[model samples]
Target chain A: MNEHSLTAEIIAILRKAPSVALFSHVSPDGDCLGSMLAIGLALESLGKTVTFFNPDPVPAGLTFLPGAERVQQVLPQPKPQTLVFVDCTDLRRVSLTPDYLRDSIVVNIDHHISNQRFGHFNWVDDQASACAEIVLSLINQLGVTINRDIATNLYTAIVTDSGCFQYSNTTANTHRLTAELIEVGLNLALIHHNIFDQKPLAQVKLLQAALNTLELRAGGRLAVMSLTLEDFQKSGAQQELSEGLVNHARSIQGVEVAVLLKEVGPQEIKIGLRSNLWLNVNEIAAQFGGGGHKRAAGCTLNVSLAEAKQGVCQAIEEGLEIGRDH
Target chain B: MNEHSLTAEIIAILRKAPSVALFSHVSPDGDCLGSMLAIGLALESLGKTVTFFNPDPVPAGLTFLPGAERVQQVLPQPKPQTLVFVDCTDLRRVSLTPDYLRDSIVVNIDHHISNQRFGHFNWVDDQASACAEIVLSLINQLGVTINRDIATNLYTAIVTDSGCFQYSNTTANTHRLTAELIEVGLNLALIHHNIFDQKPLAQVKLLQAALNTLELRAGGRLAVMSLTLEDFQKSGAQQELSEGLVNHARSIQGVEVAVLLKEVGPQEIKIGLRSNLWLNVNEIAAQFGGGGHKRAAGCTLNVSLAEAKQGVCQAIEEGLEIGRDH
Candidate 1:
């Protein structure tokens, strides 16, 4: 079915459901949480009972999102007949057992191209920058006015996923949808502050420690930054706080490949790979039993930090060399 | 006159002009350069002879902009009859004397609220997120079809000035204009890379050195990060590379006031101030013989870096106390 008709059918299904349970992916990002909450708020306004669930706690920076408090960590007893999975590539992404979905009419809404279409009704739009874009369309079709709260949720989703409209996923429709969200009286200044500006002190300290280990190799074609366990402990930062440190290395001028190795355990290192233009980091990552997209990928090494660094750097060097011949 | 009629009048004026000279402000940023180039490209399409001038050289990152090579440093001996200033707040901002303007029909196009309107024809839309927005409208009115080159220029202007659409100045119109620009087939990914991702290695090193000096005071509300002359030397970075370091301090979670003190010379320190929520930083800055907007400001002190830090910290503490009483 065409997207327009599919959207109509999803809206019809949602309208007829007495109660809907919305689930977000594990370690939920702004896109997932915001997408789930936006749709949940819209359904509630339509006089339907809505329950929101996420396997992990919402990140501190995203707590300001309206309806965030309502997202429970544990699933409620007697699961609703209708289940909606928002921003999940598949059921496993939510870290929930598939048994519950057996009897429920599953509706999947996501923007990931890899979505498995696990839902009885799936609306997967890789072209949409964020699932919030799809949710916004659904809300409009549901005849629910996008209030400040709904607008805030949807706006946050789009901004975070689109890297504030810097990512390649951002399209003309992303900006148009943002324009509509801004028209709904969303306090963009405050939203931007709460979402992006409010970085934890620990994260900043972690970044400092990570930058201290910056190394450039492969004739400036490869940049590497790593944070040992001691670095994390000294900064009072959790492992997850090092999420975007690889981007720092990736952003350096003249660097084609950026690598970030995190000493997560005594003999275990986590590796992140990012390539700017030519080198395929995913291919390098897959060699280490990790895989993702062409530009970004990751792997885990059950070796010392030094060994992991040496191995990854050598692989990246080879990758860069191969890229040059092309 | 209303903006519509003013835009129409300016379009009419440009349509009739035989030749035009475009000027950008000193220390040109993406917005000023992009705005100038976009207009220049559009005028060239109209078969009007166009010349671009800037008092300063275009920054290395902005050199990728189309027609960037054409931005001349010195004003031509015989200036074009029609001289247009793009993104200049005042005539002096271009850093050229008014002597050149005496014989030319000056057209002032800008988005700054403080625009002096020093033009026989002026279109200063303070509401615009970027001067490029105004230029985009002018180009459209001039009946120029926005190709990839013009679109890239305008897109860069909007993206940079809007802080990638995170700033408060961004409006529905900003995003709407961006939607139109994206439809013109501009490569969003490459543009983002050129504008933001390609940080100089020296700048990254400077950031590392600055972050090492991060200190919290006034119950963690005031965060200060300073860089000594030695720090700059060690990083091999220039003073201009420290431009956004203050924002690192400002982005801390509990930081209401953030300051970056750069030891520019012996016994000379440059102070940048940014306030997150309340605390009027401009007021604090003015106490030290510097001033800007409420949330952001700057100052210079002839005292030692230590003395400067102490004085600024005390003033910001008092400002925060005053903010609390309100």
Candidate 2:
């Protein structure tokens, strides 16, 4: 994330556009989905005909948000209007529906530093724990009604992406936002369960597969695993199953580092990384042209699954060394 | 629960006693442990000679609680002048040290309807979520410091035992207590993770094993599974790994009910029962002299493993029938 006055940029886009379609990365996560919905909700409250958009199925875990069902598939039929890309840094994230933004007024909002400024107006804050944080600030500036639903939705975005406010990226502003969100009557347990406890059978099957394949190294200080499509198919699982697997891997005893290499396709690997209390995973993610927060981050690598595992293990080793030296 | 006024009764015992020991039930869960420790902490804070006694090892998950390390194993020593059994409704719970309370001023504080009134002063309120809730009320009556650590500890106790406040037992008072605890800066994530997120390898392994054995029945509205000790041994998992395994079984799309029968010993079985949003598991647990809230409850049976499984499955079928009938 790189700092820019997102408020100024978003306001300029709103002034120039009459309607907007909001989109985030494919295979949307809580932060991505919640941020998209939170922004759409804000704009809707402002009397805009805003259409929330995404190409992939909203991961099952984040389905409870109030406006989640209205989040439509990003079909290229919203008429040449404003396309607000959220939580997506690179165009590849929206590859399936890249044309959705090709001829539209693009307003990009994200928190990944690797985000290329592909939009007509780009506002990426690498330091913010979640894009919802930026969106919250904009909502505050616009002075909209943040009812309990909106407050809970924003809280879900920030809390999940920030590892529930314990991650290093939890700036002072993060806690302050949490306080404000709770003030709006977000039942803490519902927010926690809607995002965490509600997992589909496929996700459970996938986690079982990952646990079966977990390889402990560094005398148990590191936990590594890879999930292939065959494993996914056999388990009847989905890619979203791999979402929190890395964190589970990281919880192993003495496992200061955890890595999960998910096979997107034969030669495509999406790496998810997590650490105990330390370990800078963002640097590792960036080595593969991806970027996220330090303690928990990820990247994508265009290599065979086997090769991707080797590269990530090497990167993890180097990251540990770099962390140790510093 | 039911507007308890046990403060005077408990204080009366303390007034006549120079030494006191607070013992919790065997196979202590968060509520049992929390009631033991929160009471122990409040007593220690009040300059009482209190020893937290237990018959089993503190379950691996709750070791993060403040007084966990201090919860000593019962040994041959002088008995306290006053003895308070926190969560034990039956004397068999603290049966490991039989004569330990024979002549001691035994006081039973519990929330179980089946409580046999096994002590001189029995404060049993079946309406309460747990004994910890009672202890928390007592702490409030005593006007203790209720510091962040204590509040956090008490909140964890209440949250875990109360199904994170989702169980039917949750009342305005429960919410009021929880709100006060959180308002006192009890970190919600800390409580959530301490009880739920932190899983051991064997537990994960047991989960995988349990899932492996999962089979849907009754038109997929019921799922059942088992965990043999052999499964735990293969995974290097402890008995504690059995926690939450049944919930996974119940979370399936068509599953209105779930049952997990874990072989605790050669013949004895520890059965876990869970139901979806529309089922009652408490009645099933009550058949075997155990009690829990609607969604989750369990009971142990000293029978052949096969018999235990059959008995539980039959009970679930009956419960499902009743649920359907309603």
Candidate 3:
């Protein structure tokens, strides 16, 4: 089966199966749910029996995705000969699988460069903006309908993955695909608001706390903000609600780099990085066993938040050598 | 006093002036304040006596811009040779200017394509994205020293005028100029929050009320939501707080056109328009004597809320014939 070729691969396996199970990685993002739902909707239009699954509940923010209600938290038994995972690199990221389908023929689709070759038919193309991009490529190849519903789902994936087309990762192909999506009548306003604007009152309160903690460092070249578990609890903020606070640091004038260290658990911390110039954050992240792109990247440390912050600061200090006056 | 000429125009006048008074448009946006403030700062740096006046209080949201506190609500009594106006096309829009300056030479600089050529020495370069963009070009010509504060203010002007580089008006010059501003170390994070992300609780509540009234029209191609004066008063939403609301209307799936009409006064309404493919809202707005570029536009109607809605809907209906498919 031609699993590596996005369209031929999805078609090759589903051609033989009377029923198919579709799913995504847990803690679903717009790319994960959007790709899965858009593909599931397209496949369902083709008279194919499709069951969609996710390991965890979809975040409330992404509930507007097409076919969202059809997705279940786990795969069921009596699964067909085909199982397709959209935006998931491996089964470990999936919450549950039907016992009988543990050994079922699996197809994996994703846009993560770190994707592990984890399935019988894996098509991982990181060049695409999102899994939804690959899904649309396949659907178009299969001559499936590109209606408003599918257009919305695909638009969501692209917009989310592109950071509304402001992130450095956006390429010419991203714009081309976006133009095509626009041709299909994508609603730019709704997608922007539903995904980026639907912040709760709790999130704003969280931002207030984060803003209060902003510190200027490195001769005003580095801006850092942090959140202790206590801060989160007091603000009634969840990890998700902490979105866009690091942006405050990166937003300051003269700051070359911005860092956010959040205490995720009792002794665990996650670092988020953003830069205005040549700080190779991906290199910094790799020094700590995490990796991502140049302008933005992240890492996690097993140590307490304080130690993790110090470690991140060290990485940033070294990174700034390459960043200044270049 | 040849303001429109690249020749020794404002330069000659400023060199002879003992002191200068500057102001910006009414309903001041970032571009207006940022451009005026930047010019004021640069002139002050050059050992020129300057007093910046703004009759209206800085809109609560824009207080984060540097040197905002230095802007006075009332101009100090002083005889000045020239009064500089920024970003405004009409004399009616001047916020804070001494009545004595009406006899002095007026130097009006703007980027409004529709500017009526209303000043003694008017330089209106509508091709520029913002008045700040024009200011930057003029400053470079004058060999004025540009520093971080000036750059930060200039950056705000372009970012706001270009809608953070997402509006159709964004150009190669916009990006190039922004890239230069970033090199000077402007805090885009604070700028974004101050200009884009800072929403009052009342505005949020007003948004919820607006979203509650969303409806799909024109064969699932038009989405609309409106606000009565009651809605704004109940939520304490000020006129400036309605900045990004039109975007909400254009976000609905399958929406080709979006309309947002708000009560501007007890008996008047203001209309905002946005179009995806297959709609031309600019032409509709033109019928009411308002003009803007295609894709987005606005108009004001002196009618009761009910009559305004009827008139706008009729125009939208009449203008649909020319809406594009791609």
Candidate 4:
């Protein structure tokens, strides 16, 4: 369906629905959690029963969202008349049983270009910076007065998904909508600090360990960093804290491609690749039986850390050469 | 003068001036640099001879600004008809000879709360998030169309001064202006990447060394980190790279006060202090012959690093105790 008609259909179904259930991808981040909460709160305000479901618990950093505590692991009873999937590119990402909800009207709302139209009503806009941006438009169309609490949730979603407005996906309309949301009295600092700052001591320790092993290749064009299992144990940091570590390597002045290899087991390693402008790491991840976006991609290699590092760095060098030639 | 009349007076002067000279504080930050460039570019487009002056060279990160190369270290000849001091809390900050332009009409434009209004026309609005915001208004009132270059400069000013819109000073108007600037075809990601993401490898090395010495004082209520001159020399990092090191310490989960002591010489030490919520560090800095806002402050001590750290940490502990009692 065209975006206009799909949006209208979704709105029409939502307005008359007796109950609505919201599902987001597993291991939800700020965008999914904030989008779910904002829409659920809006529906509740309209006197409709709303159930928010997440396959995995909200990450530690994003629990501050207003309605985060209400997210349930299992689908609620009294089957929802309307099922809205937000921020999930694939239906399996939601990790919910597909058999029971066959009768309900399905609505897929996402901002990802890769979103599969797994719903009866699909409204996907790749240009939207975040799913929350789409939700904001829907709320405005529904004539719902966005209260302060709802505004805060929406703001969190945009800020996190846009990397606090630093990402390329952030557009002019993103800032305009953010301005309108702030008008509803959002505390930009409190939310920003709680989300970006307030890092645990262990995280910094892990960062230190990760940087200690930093290496440069391709005449400073490639930056490689690694963390052994021992480093995580020594720092008392969980493996999750290693997230964004490769970005550190990519931040180097002359580096184009950054790779991080983490030892998950004695002979197993997880490889992450990040590129600055030109190099496409997704193809490199595909060779390793995984894939992601152009600038960021990842894969798991059942090889020793040293072997994985050598193979990934060689692949990135070839990619960079190809990119330069192009 | 009231803010309304002050803004009107400045606008009137700019409209009629044959030429204008722009002055920002020495060691200019993103806000000052961005504000100066935006206004100067706008005036230059109006066929006015504009001279942009800064006592210190543009910092490495901000040299990406469009007009950064045009900023002069020394005063230019044929004095301008109008002298506009932007982003300066005090006249001395501009560091220009006081006698050279004593008779010129001085316009002080700032957003700092402590501005002294030391200008024939003063437009100081602390409520405005950044001085760049004020410049945006003045350009609009002057009826100058904001081009892509001017928009980039103004956006840089706001993003830097507002800490990427995370600081408390950011308001609804800030985002609105940012959205307008974005509409002018500013590349948000390129500017953000150049300003925030492109850190030198030396800076990361310096960070590693500083984190190695991370110390917790006052029973974990205070976190302290120190780096000696040798550490800078060995890591190939300059003293300026230590600007935000204290923020890392302040980010610890429970730490109320975070301090960074840098050895400037055998005896002199440069100190930076940051507070999360309670316990005013500015008062503590004042006790040591320095002062600033309640949360972030700085000072210099002509004592050994060991002595300075001990004294400052004790003062912070006492302040925390007093704050708790209150």
User: For this target, which candidate reaches the highest lDDT against the unseen true structure?
Assistant: 1
Tell me how far candidate 3 lies from the true structure as C-alpha RMSD in angstroms: 12.7
lDDT of 3: 0.74
Residue-level lDDT tens digits of model 1 in B1-326: 88788878888889999899999999999999999999999999999999999999998899999999999999865777899999998978998767768978889999999898889889998999999999998898899999999999999999999988888899999999999999999877788888877898999999999898999998999999999999999989989889988898898997888999999999999999998888888888999899998899999999999999999898888888777675
Candidate 3 C-alpha error for residue B320, in Å = 32
lDDT of 1 by residue, A207-265 (tens): 99889889999998899999999998998998888888889999999888899999999
Best by TM-score: 1
The ten-residue window of minimal lDDT in model 4 chain B covers B94-103
The DockQ ranking, best first, is 1, 4, 2, 3
Candidate 3 residue-wise lDDT, A118-153, digit = tens: 777778888886787788888887678788889889
Provide the overall lDDT of each model, using Cα atoms, as 2-decimal numbers: 0.91, 0.76, 0.74, 0.88
Candidate 4 lDDT, tens digit per residue, B1-326? Answer: 67677778888899889899999998899999999999999998888889999999998888899999999998878777699999999878987555755889998899999997788888888999899999999999988999998998899999999988888998889999999999998877678768877788888888888888998887888999999999999988989887887888888877889999999889999899998877787888899999998889889999999999898988888888787665
- Stretches of candidate 3 off by over 4 Å are A1-6, A96-103, A263-271, A281-326, B1-326
Predicted complex 3: CAPRI docking category: incorrect
Instruction: State which candidate, 3 or 4, has the greater TM-score.
Output: 4
RMSD of 4: 2.8
- The TM-scores, one per candidate, come to 0.96, 0.67, 0.53, 0.92
B255 Cα displacement, candidate 4 (Å) = 3.8
| Candidate 1 docking class | high
Poorly placed runs, candidate 1 (over 4 Å): A287-289
Chain A TM-score values, per prediction: 0.92, 0.72, 0.84, 0.91
